[model samples]
Target chain A: MSMPENEIREIEAFLFLEARLADESRYDEWEALWTEDALYWVPRRADLDPAKEVSHIYDNRQRIGTRIRQLKSGFRYSQTPASPMRRVLSNIEIAPAGADEYEAGANFMLMELAIQSTRNMNFWGGRTLYRLRRVDGGLRMVVKKILLIDADEPIANLSFLI
Target chain B: MGMQRTIVYDALVHRDRVHGSLYTDPGVFSDEMDRIFHKGWSFVGHTSEVPNIGDFKRRQIGLQPVIITRNPDNEVRLLFNRCTHRGNMICAKESGNTATFVCPYHGWTFGVGGEMRGVPLQNGMGKDFDKSAMGLANVPRMRIYRGFIFASLAAEGPSFDAYLGKARKLLDRACDMSPDGEVDLSAGWLKHRFHANWKMLPENNTDGYHVNVAHASLMRAVNAFSSQAFDEDKGDNSVTRDWGGGHTELDFAARYHQTGRPFQWFGGVPAAKMPDYVARMEQAYGKDLAQQHMIEGPPHAILFPNLFLAELNISFLIPISANEVVQYYTPLLLKGAPEVNARALRQTEGAMGPGSFLLPEDACMAERNQLGLAAQSPEWLDLRRGLEREYMDEKTGLLSSAVSDEITNRSFWKEYLQLMSSFPGAAA
Candidate 1:
């Protein structure tokens, strides 16, 4: 069944804002949007069991906290001079929800320009699955799982959050 | 400022430094591919990759691609992917199984054993033409230690055993850690590219000097999220060794497994599951040995020139050119322990996957190193840190040093120099 129009629009706006927070390197604001027990996963391959097969990023809230902490440390050489990125989110679909949780899926295209001794731009497209819960009449993400089109291929860097 | 194309071993390689051209010159990369890679026993893939009959996978040793397969007869064979007719690649798929590989170009078919089976319209060739004479060319030497398969392009060199030497013990240890004394590579792999010379990676794998500075971001993140999970002040005592013949290891398991606290990398397995995991280990091995295994950290084993088996994964390094390399990271699965295997996969994902925090940093450093090598003023890359602290074993000629010592790189260069200099007057 299709999502209600209002829910779809709300989810789209939330995802867009989430992308904006990361694109602007507003890490602290981005971190706050996640629930206490959040899960963020990026599978290395489209057909992989994160528990059995390896993932690009299979993180708990603590791990996400660690990642943000590292990125903020100004020593993550890969992102020391942080790559500038813009993510375009589209095709938002809100799946059925539990008592308070709504599952939202969206397609994203992230364009990143990285300058590390040389200038290179990468266009990464993927489908992101997010689990959002109603918190104080707004929404907070409990899980975000990203599956990239070229997940199995070798990439130079994915230093920035996608 | 003119620099000679020929690499003079004595001038280019020293106790502490190596010439910058070794990282930049395309001619040197070609020579090394022929001399070092072709002659040396480079690892291609594991037997586990093609476990069943008719299973096959394509792998590379330097620039040459070969198909690693287990035929219907259950014999593992390495067949050149190149078709005999017009030198076109016979198979394009990275991995799969077929009783016969048909060249799409001409429908020329070859068996899994690499024998020429059928040629489309054989009547076109002269009556004297023989199909028996034409078959896929096999690599000169193929050997498997435990499950790791290594092949040599040149016909003669050191025996695989002799070449492995002390490195063999570590490989055995890696497998022995598995409850059933077996490891499988069926899980699949992660591939990442770096704009750096191939040598930089093997060196980085064994170098402890970069851990503090290069991986500081990782350390800080882990510490911040997990109550100082990677705080340096905790006094992690690890050691690195040059296990003769260019093989090396950084043994750091003991430090992490101290007091049985769950490591930050594995996330926090439930406190109750910790004992159960130990019990599973004890079931496979006796109480004493299981405890020893638990206490000892897995050594990151780097076999000479190409392959590295470390912490539940194997990395195969393929060089595309002087300034480019591809790293294939394959996770190792323990035969019967689903929980341990899952944890291992999670830990590998957290640390080394393409989007993970650690590898990208290393790639940046390697790429920058490549760029810096272009400068003419600093003619040498230094490997001089902690040289005096190394101790040599008189019997095996293996050298041991602190985990952060430069002895690892020095030993690597020593072997590299010997191999490079073995070429008579100049590199062809």
Candidate 2:
């Protein structure tokens, strides 16, 4: 089923909000965007049929929370001179998967300026099969899978959310 | 002016420390390519990566591009990736199985084994043009230790065994863990490019002092495993021994601690399975070595110039630029191990894989160190940890060690200095 114009605008707005929160390092707000059982996955292979290839980051809500806690913790040395990153999301295409669920596809570019190093950029686009459910008068992400173009290529580190 | 800069290289050398310029200098880096990378038996990739006939992979040996392929006869061959006719890259993809490689630039084709098979517009070339003589230039010498392959650009060097010296025992033990005494590279890998001097990494591996400080997060995560096996009453400590010619091993007693906490393998294996693994290891190596492998914590073994065969996996540090290095991690499994055992091995590798809980922390530390080196002050970095215990053993010609030692780093630099110096008796 085709997504309603209102639902499409809502996803684009949601993605924009996510990009701004991450860019400003407001991770707490970003963390609040997910459902209790939501999954955030960055697959290691381009055609990451989850049954076959492993994911780089396969975080459920609890795991994602733990990551946030670590990032906030002063002891994480890699974040000493914390990396600054900005995510650019564009070309949003929203389609209905169920009555309330919608699948969103968008092109993303994450540019990270690690302290004392030149800017490193990661570019990729994929359809996000989000099982959005209405909860407390807001949409919550049930699942997010990021299929990077160079998923199999050697990467330095994904210190921040893409 | 360039000659004056060359003199600056001589001035940087000192007894206790070397200038940071040595790590940052382009001239020094180029010289290293000629002396160390080009001359030494640098690791390419494991033979298992190209197991089937027509399987091939592209690898960079220093700045040169080379392709390693398995011929129809099952012989492993390493050849320049470029087509001889037009200097076009023969194999563009990173890795794949191909019956023949055709260069898209001008239709020059080569066989899986790098033999020149065909060229378009063959009639246009004079009859004297011999295609038989036009095969891809093979790397000067290639040798395999077990299933691991190393290629050298220079034709002459010590035999592979002689170069490995006592290090062969370590590789043997790693391979012997499998019942079949072989290893396969099938579980896939993690490749990352770090913005740091390549030498710093090899130096860091054996530098035990950084574990408590640089990798504190990883240490914290693995603390649960360490606390259980540690015997506080034993008072056994870690040791870093230099196994001459730039190879070294950092050994920690089964219960040694950093930050007053015992060191542990990051992944936890069940107590029940440990004995079975030990028994299998005992069968592979004799009783004494098996006991050593089990009782002693895994050793951090660094084969100088860019190969690190750690207890968990193998990493190749290929220098891409002065400040950029590509790190490739290949998980090694004992050949013919049971499927369940392979799964366990994969789990262990996953704990250190690209998306592992540990690598991000390690990469962060390395990058931070690189940033620190860019500073104007602190011209010399220190490597004086446990300097007093770097005693050379008379019988084996190896250097013994103690806890908190930089002996391995010192040994690495000693060889680095020797390699960088111009060949004696040869005129400039």
Per-model clash counts, in order, read 2, 1
Give a tens-digit lDDT track for model 1, residues B331-417.
778776676776777667777757787888888899899888889777888788768877775654667767777887887888888
Give the distance in Å from residue B324's predicted Cα in candidate 2 to where it truly belongs: 1.6
TM-score of predicted model 1? Answer: 0.91
Question: How high a TM-score does candidate 2 get?
Answer: 0.85
Distance from true position, residue B293, model 1, in Å?
A: 2.0
Provide per-model DockQ scores: 0.69, 0.36
Candidate 1, residue B21: the lDDT equals 88
Query: Among all windows of ten consecutive residues in candidate 1 chain B, which has the lowest summed lDDT?
Result: B224-233
True contacts kept of each: 0.79, 0.32
Chain A TM-score relative to the true structure, per candidate: 0.92, 0.84
How many residue pairs clash in model 2?
Answer: 1
Instruction: Please state the CAPRI-style docking class of candidate 2.
Output: acceptable
Query: Among these predicted structures, which one has the highest lDDT?
Result: 1
